[model samples]
Target: MADRATMERIWEAHTAGEFVAQDVEATMDDDPIVVHVPTAMGGSGYDGVKDFYARWFIGRNPDDFTVRSISRTVGDDSLVDEMIVSFTHDIEVPWVLPGLAPTGQQVRIPVIAVVDFRGPRVRSERIYWDQTAVLARRRSC
Candidate 1:
């Protein structure tokens, strides 16, 4: 059973700076799925997730990127999180910015994530953020 601490540990592992694909895999179920809703950048299943993490998400964050949790709701086998993700766009972040080049501008986006677990490991995650807000911020910057 996944408790609040278990879910927090999973979240920490996912966002940790020096983690490899296998490190992430250890925190997930056999057939996990992840979706970054605005960009459709995440992957499904084992191989696909490994590839996505290795190529896009893991170690892809900019030097100043950070995630600040606004609120978190935990259940027996699920967790819901509200956060503000901020970064200076100084490098390619395909998972967040997709095909856009680095704008060298500061950006902050509010994000919400729904995570489901199975047998103390994550089964899936659906992450949401305001795309229009990001575009407007980038346009003004």
Candidate 2:
């Protein structure tokens, strides 16, 4: 039962950072799909998505995590946001780098999130980032 304000809240609150299951169930469509394309992370449908968030995304960021918006494009049914996400590699980020130990390095990665809506509730979302850029800093020249 989302309205315009809830939609706005979903955009501002969820994508700008992250959220918990209650926040998700209230703002997301009954059958929502979310994909982190670069690493093939994320999940399909409500339950799957909730599980994905619980296991990987939610509460996973380091204490120094931050996100800065670069730009955004809004449409009637969708929005695309460009952001610079920064954090200390003090936690194992399975969504971004699977099976890799934290190197204790500072990470700043550009992220693009494309989100679609069914009426006012979120229908789907796809996140993209450069895996090479994330890995390159650790490589020895």
Candidate 3:
């Protein structure tokens, strides 16, 4: 089981978009860490995870990106967070919507992330969201 403080720190960093490579290296086990996002946009292992973050996450420049937690649960070796993520689509995000150009719209979507921990380190993170809601919001804007 991982400590609550450590989990809080990790979540805080992620919400703030401050979770960098060093944070991943320090919080994840030496073994491969699996990351799964919406629309089959993620990968397994440290290198694969790093690449996804670099290309899909860190590389983008969304205006006013923020995550607001709706609920959180902690288990023996896992944590689940339900959140509302909001951002303005002022720049292209290929990972979120491949080949789709920016629509200059704002979107707010509910998201859930299930994180499994190996002792004090993270083992995997599976994130879920509705793609249709995102697309609908974009079109409505």
Q: Which residue runs does candidate 2 get wrong by more than 4 Å?
A: 1-8, 16-22
RMSD of each candidate? 2.1, 2.8, 2.5
- Winner by lDDT: 1
Tens digit per residue, CA lDDT, model 2, 1-141: 355455556777665447323256666789999999989988998899989888988878778888788998777678888999898888888888777788888888999989888877789899999998788874532
Please identify model 3 stretches exceeding 4 Å from their true place: 14-23
Best of the two (1, 2) by TM-score: 1
Q: In each prediction, how many residue pairs overlap at the backbone (N, C-alpha, C within less than 3 A)?
A: 0, 0, 0
TM-scores, all candidates, are: 0.89, 0.87, 0.83
18-137: candidate 3 lDDT, tens digit per residue: 323224555665564544466787767878877776677664757586778899998777889998877787888765665668887776788888988777777787888888777776
lDDT of candidate 3 at residue 11, scale 0 to 100 = 56
Each candidate's lDDT (Cα)?
A: 0.82, 0.80, 0.70
Q: Report the CA-based lDDT of candidate 2 relative to the real structure.
A: 0.80
Name every residue pair that clashes in candidate 1: none
lDDT rank, highest first? Answer: 1, 2, 3
> Which ranges in model 1 have alpha carbons more than 4 Å from their true place?
17-22
